[model samples]
Target: MKALLPTGDPREPVVLADVPEPTPRPDEALVKVEAFSVNRGETFKLEAPAPGDRPGKDVAGLVVQPAADGSGPNGIARVVGHPMAGGWAEYAAVPTDALAVLPDGVSALQAAALPLAGLTALRLLRTAGPVLGRRVLLTGASGGVGHYVTELAAAAGAEVTAVTRDAERGARLIELGAAAVVHDLADAPGPYDLVLESTGGPSLATALAKTARRGTLIWFGQASRRPATLDFFAFFDGPESAVIRHFHYLDADTSLGDDLAALVRLTAGGRLHPEIGRIADWADTATVLTDLRERRIRGKAVLTLA
Candidate 1:
């Protein structure tokens, strides 16, 4: 099997090599990986390289064998899930409990893109608010997680406000079900029922200010690579009080297959759109990683194992 690994040098973060095939554990199944998605975490991990360690987490492929304990559905099936470290490979050993069997309508590419970003969006929405029938605001509405958040929140019957730096993409977001899309937070009013904040720095402050009195704001990412400072008086002596919560998505804890299964069903039923912004052969893995790290790609970038 071929796997992507860190080179232990920040200047040269990743390298590809022939590695031994993974042996499945009792609760795990062997998957012949077809496609996988690149995430910001993979890019950030490149900063501190670890030699011989596989860096990816998301994969979608055909299950070659079932778990030894038969904990999940039986037989071979197309599945989407997270591998502890070896997802960026031709094969991976994934825990059966974390796997979601993809329906016939969902492609390997689409399934690969959903496990991380889709699950993160679902978990964040659940942690913050149901968002249904509420005034919801989502920042970074053009990124991988943002697109899912925008579409899913809207699908849940919420009045969704999507914020993106690219005003041109706002139209597509509205088509995804957001009530309106704006170029920045200033264009949106404060007191939203819930705010999903992805970009950090100034955007964090904006989300904090825009959250409705007693509304919930979930901050998950720091794409801006800057710090946000807050004013005590502005927060405490404000017209109303608000709660700002931080979020991090760990597939092991956050996903028990329910959310991914629902998302897979939504994709299969045509109610949810999968945003695969870029697709390339595994030979182009470095290029895809660089594009994602530079923020040049809009949504999910998938690498196919040929």
Candidate 2:
């Protein structure tokens, strides 16, 4: 099996290498990966994988070898979700509890996009509580997680204000049913009932000030890669009451499989859309990885296996 490898040099990072196939444990399922998507976290960590290590978390494919206990799908039942590692290869051995059986109408490309980013968005929105008839402020509204937040928030009937630095992405976000789209915090509507913030640092400060009295704010991603500093007095001066929450997705989480499955059903029903921006052959892994590292992709970039 051929999998993408990091060359350990920052100047020229990734290379495709022939790796041995994986073996499944009794509790795991061996999957023939049909497609996989690149996450920003993977793009940031381009260090060379140690021997027997493969990079990638989100993958969708057919379950070639089911768990011995009959806990996972057998035969050709399609599945999609997170893997501990080695998902970049032609096949992966994932724990049966980590995968969700994908629906008939959803393609492997779309399923591959759902695991990490989609789960983060779903969990954060749930943490923020109901937003059916309230103003919601979403920052970093362009990347993988941001795109899902935009669509899911809109589907929940929230009046969404999507904030993105890219004009093209801003336009596309509105098509996802955002009530309003803007480039910065200054341009968004004030006193939001709920804020789904991904851009930390100064953007978080702005989002805090824009939050309505007694509203909730969920900070999930640090895309800006800056330190977030807030003045204690200014932030809690009693003018507007705010509740802040921080969240990050964990791979060993047991509930993620169920969440990913629900997302797949929603997508197959046309209520959720996971856009695949750049589709490249798996042989061109370096190019797709380069585009993700350079922040050149507007939406999720999927690499297809031949």
Task: Name the best candidate (by lDDT).
Answer: 2
TM-score for each candidate, following the candidate numbering: 0.94, 0.93
Q: Model 2, residue 239: displacement in angstroms?
A: 6.0
lDDT string, candidate 2, 43-101, tens digits: 66775556655678999999988888778686667999688688888889888878899
Report the lDDT tens digits of candidate 1 across residue range 1-306.
788877755455667898999999999988999999988777887887665568777899999989899876579888998776888888899988678998788999999898888888887877765666899888888888888988888888899988888865787898898898889788887578888887788878767888777888888888787898777566765426787788977623445577779889989999878888899997778778887888788889999998
lDDT of 2 at 89: 82
Give me the displacement of residue 189 in model 2, in angstroms.
Answer: 2.6
